[model samples]
Target: MNYSIGDFSAITGISIYTLRYYEKESLIIPARKENGRRSYAESDIAWIQFIKRLKDTGMPIREIQKYAKLRAQGVTTMADRMEMLARHRAVLKEEIGKLEEHLSNLDDKITYYRTEIRKCTNLREDRRTAEVSCCT
Candidate 1:
């Protein structure tokens, strides 16, 4: 079913202003009604969702625009699209590796601190026992 621009924005969880910006950026081109208002179709919903995902994945606007251009060119551009996605995937993998390394370092520091605290506590307890026995 066709929806007006406002309805489309609400359904897609994108603001009306961003929808207009996307049109200006060539990320989306909604159909126009006879009165010249923007009209969106079910297919547009899926397209916008994919565009949002690409943005969330750190794809720059220029790259997304290029991908959209390729997409508009039809099935022949599938290889180029796949290559772009694969490149982005590799970047994400590298970032994940760095984050995991940082997390491991933090865990090691936490364990070291806990072990040091336990040692200090044990020393304090031993000193207190020696003082009490000498007083007795």
Candidate 2:
């Protein structure tokens, strides 16, 4: 069943304005009713979700528009789509590597701080014990 733009936006968690922007950008083209109202389908839901994923993964709008154009061309563009996705995947992998390195650095710093805190605590306790023994 086709859904009105409001319903589609609710279902997709995309704002109505952004949906209109997507249509304007040619990233998506919802069907227009006789009244010129935008209508979306189940297929549009899946397409929009995929589009969101691409956006989340740092794919530029221009690149997404290119992919959308290729998709509109049908099965003949599968190889082209695959190539685009492969390139995106490589970029994501590189980003993941850098993030992992940053996380490791954070972990090392946290470990160092913990060790230093423990040493300070031990030194304070030892000092207190020595002072008590010498005064007794």
Candidate 3:
């Protein structure tokens, strides 16, 4: 089934302007209606989702454009596309490793601060009780 540009944008969560920009970048090519409006095929939605995932992965525009070009080239380019994806995966793994290290560091700092606060709570209670001294 085909969808209007507006429907496509709602379904894909991509702005109409971004969709047009994708077309300009040759990342997607939606069919045109007789009146020159866009008619997005169901496959176009899937393609858009894939593009979104690539963008989320921090893939550069030129790299995604290369992947899109490879996709347009049909099954014969499968190996080439796989190579590109493999390289991207390696980089992503490295990035994830660094992120995990940072997360661990943050968690350690939070634990240290929490312990310090707990230790200070007793001091605070002692100061409050000692000041009043409650002499009857």
Candidate 4:
């Protein structure tokens, strides 16, 4: 079924302006009515959802647009699409490595603070014991 721009916007959670912008950016191409109204298909809705996911993953508009273009061109571009996915995977790997390094640093800091706290608590306990003996 074909959906009007408003229906597309409501169902896809993309604003009408953004839907237009996506068309302008070549990220999406909805069918146009004779009067120039945009008619989106269910497939277009799915594509928009995928685009949103790619954006959330930090894919740039240009790259996403390119991917969308390649996708629309069909299975002949499979190798190129694979290359794109490989590039994205590399970026994700680097990001994961950075996060792991940050986590390690945080863990070390936590260990250091915990050790200091234990020492301080032990010292306080020693002081309390000495005072009790002296009072006796």
Which has the greatest lDDT?
2
Using all chains and alpha carbons, the TM-scores for the candidates as numbered come to 0.82, 0.92, 0.91, 0.77
Candidate 3 lDDT over residue span 59-84, tens digit each: 99899999999999999999999999
**Across residues 4-59, which tens digit of lDDT does each residue of candidate 2 receive?**
99999999999999999999999999999999999999999999999999999999
For model 3, the stretches where C-alpha displacement exceeds 4 angstroms are 129-136
Q: Between 1 and 4, whose TM-score is larger?
A: 1
Looking at model 2, report the run of 10 residues with the lowest lDDT sum: 127-136
RMSD of each: 5.5, 4.8, 4.8, 5.5
How would the candidate models be sorted by lDDT, starting from the highest?
2, 1, 3, 4
Question: Which candidate, 2 or 4, has the higher TM-score?
Answer: 2
lDDT of 1 by residue, 17-131 (tens): 9999999999999999899999999999999999999999888999999999999999999999999999989998998999999999999999988887777667668886533
Look at candidate 4 and give me any clashing residue pairs.
none
Worst 10 residues of 3 by lDDT: 127-136
Clashes of each: 0, 0, 0, 0
Candidate 2 Cα errors over 4 Å, as ranges: 129-136
Model 4 lDDT per residue over 73-119, tens place: 99999999989989998998999999999999999999988887777
TM-score of model 4 vs. true structure: 0.77
Better of 1 and 2 by lDDT: 2
Clashing pairs in 1: none
- State each model's CA lDDT, in order: 0.92, 0.93, 0.91, 0.88
Which 10 consecutive positions of candidate 1 have the poorest summed lDDT? 127-136
